[model samples]
Target: MTTIDHAVVLGGSIAGLLSAAALAPRAHRITVVDRDPLPLEGPDAQVARRGVPQGDQIHHLLMRGQERIEELLPGIGDELLALGCEKYDDVADFSQFVDGAWRMRIQSDLKVTMFRRPLFEWAIRRRVLALSNVTVVKGMAVGLLASSDGARVSGAKVRGAPGGTLAADLVVDATGRGSRSPFWIEDLGYERPVERHVRIYMGYSTWTVRLPEGALPKGLAGISASASPANPFGVAIRPCGNGLHDVAAYGMAGHYPPDDLDAMAGFFEELDSPVIADVMKKAVPASEIVPYRMPGNQRRMWEDLPRRPENLVVVGDAVTSFNPIYGQGMTMAALGAGVLGDALAEAGTLDGLAETVQARLGPLAQVAWDLAVGADSVYPQAEYENVEPPSARDRDRARAQSAAQSAEGAVRVAMRATALYMDPAYLGSPVVQETIDRWLTSGHKPAPEVTDPTDPPDVTPGVVRAADLLEPATAAGRLAG
Candidate 1:
């Protein structure tokens, strides 16, 4: 049986809440600490809290993430759907443009949920805090509390408290990309973990918009255009909920998207596809364009540390903060929660738990890390640390991967596997390899029917007011104000 009694989880974002869920069954009591106050009400009360600055950004549950979440909190999928989240085939209902071409969309089982990030996080947090054993404390965690011997983390030190130390049998740091785990561990007399960073200098400006009544052209639930070196700009437009769509414009290497709606339309004309631009030109803006900037992709190599606290482990963005443009953080967090549950079940004790769990979590992040970094390498000014520059061979491989995703047969399998969070190596399977090889040799030709082309759809700017799209209940919600 697990020896854990009370555990402390820092940062109550999606990651922290999920970590609490994973430990709640084994630990007699779990206290989740956050910089932002816990959401007492349901998803309706949820918004981009001060804790998650990017909470207002667009987000989705890739199929695998959807499954993992369902496993942790049964029927969450249904709850979200009933709450206005849209579920659709990832490829069939969504169009992804890469390498100046649209990915072949096909009917498949791979599906994802599109909803506001705050609502989803709220749903997960609500469920996690509902566990009788779990409690949430509002505060900012400053450091780790270590035993006198400096071998095991005994608790956490918050900025303000009855004293300052909140004791625990275990400490979980889910403080996200700005995590101070390395500094805290080093302060506790352990060596700092090595860090790897890939700088893309990414920027985002997202707006809530109202689309035409029935859906935009060919029933496409969403559209994404990946940024290339030549263009250096990207756009992602997806339906959030209540007939409102979240349109985000991003750029790589410091080419920030414009905040002005008209300028944004002009920015889209430079993209590979005019679909998003056309829609944006016609959609009614429901909210101001909110901008977010990320320095780059970063990962702390804690698993490589020779010595570490036995009763502590870091999870989620704290470990690997991937480029948010890929929408991998939430999914990776869910997977890490599952891995933590497995590690606990295997060890049955807190002894050496940090090392064992951190090691396993490293592999879980490798696939997403590689995908993000490899894809980001295409930009002109991409920077790297603790990683080598891409060679000609590396560039060729990246190009080939892009071509594979652009092809029909290969992309279907590759995309489905990726959406399901399968190993990136699966793209190297015999079937995928064969399809990619054939496409390469055949001069990169897509099928005759690349898409279900719809008639030139009518899009009229200011046709639908913001008041018409958003539910009155959300009037006092964060974005509404």
Candidate 2:
């Protein structure tokens, strides 16, 4: 095993904290640096801070991410719940409207824990700080310190208390989308990573509201309506604990949701489903309506560079930032840390660790980039280079698959892919294809409406009920048979 004397992680958010945790077992000492003076205790610790602009936004930990995080920091799920987080079934307690129809609800083991971004970060920050070898420094990382040959990073240059070139055996950048790593690397005579951008022009307006008891239909913990070209507006409402829910209205292609509360409610009213708008009628706004916008998805092709500093690796949004609408940012950050850990274990030394990890992270980031950008490509205004817009047939195929959510098997595969539990190729598997065929033959009827809040969910027509369908073994068995 290669012994790491010290590792310095830039940025103290989810990615930075998780990176520190990943380094704790191998490195003798790990220091996490961030611009914000991270709160250690009290109510302030659990709420949005100045550093994290999106801290007030809604965030959820996908089942896969939650599992990976639990592995990195055991009992974190329980701790989050103790701190007033809410865990709900991914399918059973959720409602979604897509492709001009309501999707059939099916019970599944996939769980999603909901919390504001700040609380989630705080939870991980607390756990990372608990490790005897890990400590956090209040500082802003400005550049990289390199060895005499400039072949490896020696430390980081910071701009606050104890600020200087903090020497380390390994340097990890988790500085997010605004990172200056590229310029710093270029300054060291290394090639700058190629950047890819997809212009989405997406906008979001969110509010934290206290819903009246039974505001949402019974058995439904959250509701969402996906945005499309036909109806460019969408709404997502999810529980954020303490009797509060985060309600967000989003639009794409310059059809930005209004910041005014009344106008935002009006925006929801335009969605395909009236459920969200109706519920908003009784929701008491607990916080100011917050608005955020994104230019598009951006990614740095670090692996494509012929050479990079050996002891440095960039993680999280610094590598690739997806459109926030997909909610893949935090999950991807956790997975990136896992990749970093894997690279460390495989390399058995710091030499060439950065290059190896960058190569591995490329494919991982491509998964999310493709998913987010593919969906965004549907809009004519979405701009990208060297990538063709999805053909009409492709669009039709996607729409058909979405409509196929009327079948339990189809819903299982689709939701699993959405949760990042399976490869998207599973969407084209024999089972999903067969299910889609069955759904198409059945006229693609929309899910029945439930007029009453306490009424049982309506089962869709031509449904295929298979309890073991979601299991990998069962899926493989079906493929073989």
Q: Top lDDT: which candidate number?
A: 2
Q: What's the residue-level lDDT of 133 in candidate 2?
A: 98
CA-lDDT, candidates in order: 0.75, 0.78
Tell me the lDDT of model 1 at 38.
Answer: 79
Off by over 4 Å in 1: 42-44, 392-406, 422-481
Weakest ten-residue segment in model 1 by summed lDDT: 456-465
Error of 1 at 106 (Å): 0.3
Candidate 2 TM-score over all chains jointly: 0.90
Can you tell me which runs of candidate 2 are displaced by over 4 Å? 161-163, 393-404, 422-473, 476-481
- Cα TM-score per model: 0.88, 0.90
Q: Which residue pairs collide, candidate 1?
A: none
